[model samples]
Target: MVLPNLNWRAFIRSQPINIMSRSFAAIFAGYLVAATGSGLLALIIPLPASQSVLIAMMLSFSFYVAAAIWAFSVGTSRQAWRDLLLISAILYIFILWVS
Candidate 1:
């Protein structure tokens, strides 16, 4: 059996933008979908919802800000931005789930 050795450094340098763009798009799209869905749920599912209009707006803003940061962070610290997006998304979901 032959094992392939993947060189991460070379891979990272070879397609920085590709990785960043895909990460950014995925994060952005995922957040947008969640936010939109939350908005719809907020309207439809009424039951002492913890998410107020102000909170929802804030979350929406945070998603946009994260995406803008992700765009700028590319070619500089793609990994850091990628982690940020992931963490933010997770936090958003956690909040939605808990609250």
Candidate 2:
């Protein structure tokens, strides 16, 4: 009896481009949003400087988680990038304006 040869290459496949783009946006763009948003928050919060910074740092985590979830949950990776980048840009502009 002869054993049939199996093609292993057929079983392997690369990740879809959308997934990679979304992952990139989730990690990098998300961080941008969180960092800039935190900076802006730190500047504007009414508490003492130190306490405001602490509060912003804590809120930054929520922003990051929300960004990551949003990246994956959106209908398209393009939308995710647009939203995160837009928010990051707005936060950055606010930070510059405030301080």
Q: Which ten residues in a row have the lowest lDDT in candidate 1?
A: 37-46
Question: Tens digit of lDDT per residue, candidate 2, span 1-99?
Answer: 996785554322234767888999999999999999899999999999999999999999999999999999998788999999999999898888988
Off by over 4 Å in 1: 1-51, 74-81, 96-99
Report clashes for each candidate as comma-separated counts: 0, 0
Model 2 quality (TM-score): 0.80
TM-score versus the correct structure, for each prediction: 0.38, 0.80
Model 2 misplaced stretches (Cα beyond 4 Å): 1-15
Give lDDT tens digits, candidate 1, residues 1-99: 986998877776766655665566556654654476456445544456565555655566655566555555655555555555565566557656755
User: Could you give the C-alpha RMSD of every candidate to the true structure, in order shown?
Assistant: 6.7, 6.7
Looking at model 1, the pairs that clash are none
